[model samples]
Target: MTEHATRHTPPEGPPGDGDVLLVTDLSRRFGDLIAVDGVSFRVGRGETYGLLGPNGAGKTTTISMVAGLIEADAGTVTVKGHRMGPARVEPKRHIGLVPQELAIYPELTARENLTFFGRLQGMSGTTLASRVEDVLDVIGLSDRAKDPTKEFSGGMKRRLNIGIGLLHEPELLILDEPTVGVDPQSRNSILESVESLSTAGMAVLYTTHYMEEAERLCDRIGIIDSGLLQAEGTRDELIRLTGDVDHIRLDGSGDTVAAEAALLALPAVEQVDRERHTLHLAVHDAPTAIAEIVTEATSAGMRLNDVQITRPNLESVFLRLTGKALRD
Candidate 1:
């Protein structure tokens, strides 16, 4: 939401100074089909970089390579200046990955789950104890830490899954759809926790199907389709590429032909369509031009009944680029 980056892959050199994650010309294959084709992006310190795509879009595959959970058939993944791979242990310490599926035990309490994962990452004694409590607070689950995960709400358990990933406080955190099936209130809490993490200076690589989440949480976003990184930039920057214009519609009575003639002469109006008593207009800067458009139509002898405007957002851009809705 604050900082931004468009460096999909930096120039060949030591991984772009402060870049926490650098993926360049990354590719992968599953038998004959290409699952990931030349995808690249970077996540800088304190930056929340969102990767958005529908199912079977190579999002999860890319995350797996970045986390070194799997090997890349081609290209490279560097984390905190070290090369990353499944066999590479050192660089793995700087990365924390929270998968889409719930990675917790229903029999264990929140605190127990944190302590267990913390110990797996080599923490013990007071350090693990302190971190478990801290994470419980960060996830807004402090009061419910002792309840079995099965007793927790869907959102609560999801938060605990995120807390497990946060236990080590790695420099780069990769979250894959952390709010998939949770209730709205719980989803908001998870979002708030992520915001706080970004503010505290942790780099995050996020992937989601929600446009609002990307617009709200990410400093920059990368849209992937058919195993390719289609575009990357800040929300406003990407929207500008859509070349999408706002619309103004007018429903009225009286001289429709005269109003159509007058509306065409307006500088802001791009095109107009008329069907019976209503005129549908394609216009730029609708907010600033609506008043002028309404006056012109009324002056042309059309008595106005109602007016409406539709503006473009991230979803519009997504639809334009991918030829499908984000959820589709």
Candidate 2:
């Protein structure tokens, strides 16, 4: 690729002000299947850009190209102003990738593992040692720094995996589904670490199938499905793309038909559907409509089990656009 097609020089100053990563019209295909179809997005320094999609939604394929592991059939990927390719060491040097799969050595102590990876990136002597210590503290494994990784809990190992990526102090950190199978506590810990990294001025590209994760961490999100980028924006912007109102789910043991009819009659309610004992309502204003809905249900002789008012969010927006949940 030509230098003009790949590199972009920022205006100058602190990171996150100008775009740190720019991907334009990137496309990749495997025989008959187009895994990533003309995908494009940007990540500013210190900002987290989430690629949200379900399994088999091309999120992995997209990131593989960005990471320079796979070449794109079309378009360009520029990292901090340098084009990404197998031979482009400078651009790759600016990226720190923590893949979905664990990349640490189970038999090595945490310190040893960090030192080895740091040395691979050309770090040495006091600098590598200090960087390893810093990474150990950052990943919350300072106390367990001497323990063999095999003895660590799943969460600790995952954290160590992340630390390995940070050893080189790359400008961009790409975390691909960092919390896949860990317990809730570990998941929260991982999210907190990511937040801290972004706060410290590291640009992050986070990919996940979890709606809550995306909502919690991403400054902006790009929703991809079936190899296509369906939508891209902030949480509120994506919700607006759905063109639907708020949602309320009522769980009760009552006359179901009457409850649906009553809620549908309310001006604030736009649509109503039933699934088992739950009444799903699409409404203009959930806060305003919920009280009336509860009143209607109680009047219908239904014993209240639960009442939930859900605002338009990433999940709802995904459902509206793709007719499937983020998990599906």
Candidate 3:
């Protein structure tokens, strides 16, 4: 895959302007299963944070608690410094959630749906009408505002789902897999919309299993697995967890065991493993280590088919920490 430019950049220091939300020791359970265990993090105003992990990793559950969809079994959830619970309407009004499932009505027009949600938040009259139009224009669906949502494409429906959340002008917006099951064009449009919103000073909590999306959009990411937070940092910071190792993939034929032993014996080699006919090696330096491995393999009568050296990335760090591939 060809590389693309990234928009995410790590902050120089702690996010200090104003914390929009703070979660402390968040925990949740369902019978014998611990869905979320002591997951704690903070989101600053206008900052875009991400929760990334494999399927069934409790990312959804943690966000659900934060959105007040479900009560946590333990720990505290505060939004804009106000504790979250069923009793706090003021805090709830400041947050908006766009769930993975489309929450728009099929029979209602896009404009009608926005008006309904806006009214529920106690907005009405010319103010509500103006806000609805503003959101439609921002989502690039102003021309379709009067059309019934049943006739809209999958992408259009997804955009309306996001528009409904923005009607309230929320202090924080939580998106749970908002781009799933959409076309590439729609996905790109949605990402651009999110970027524009963040630039307008909106705090966003994005949850997705897609690494490239997180790498492109998030300022910092927190990776979770089976209810436990495994790592939390910017993309570069997390990649640094792999140390100075550079990944090298080679395909060749020799005594696999002997080849692994020879590679490990090299001074710069940190770790080596074999799968099928391929050898995966992690080394401190790319040029010198590649030279040593190639020379040793040639001496062992092995014919290398292909060799590629790659820098440490989020995927490699995930594998090193979890002992399994992210897709596994």
Best prediction by lDDT: 1
Number of clashes recorded per candidate: 0, 1, 0
Error of 2 at 108 (Å): 2.0
Runs in model 3 with CA error above 4 Å?
A: 1-17, 247-309
Give residue 12's lDDT in candidate 1 (0 to 100).
57
Better of 1 and 3 by lDDT: 1
Report the lDDT tens digits of candidate 3 across residue range 58-148.
Answer: 9899989999988999988788878887666877988998998889999999999999999999999999999999999988889999999
Could you give candidate 2's per-residue lDDT for residues 123-215 as a string of tens digits?
A: 999999999999899888999999999999898989898899889988899999999988999899899989998999999999999999999
Q: Between prediction 1 and prediction 2, which has the larger TM-score?
A: 1
User: lDDT of all the models against the reference?
Assistant: 0.88, 0.85, 0.83
Q: List the residue pairs that clash in candidate 2.
A: 16-45
TM-score of 1: 0.85
- Model 3 clash pairs? none
Span of 10 residues, lowest total lDDT, candidate 2: 1-10
TM-score, prediction 2: 0.79
Per-candidate TM-scores read 0.85, 0.79, 0.77
Comparison by TM-score, 1 against 3, better one:
1
Which pairs clash (backbone N, Cα, C closer than 3 Å) in model 1?
A: none
Q: How accurate is candidate 2 locally (lDDT)?
A: 0.85
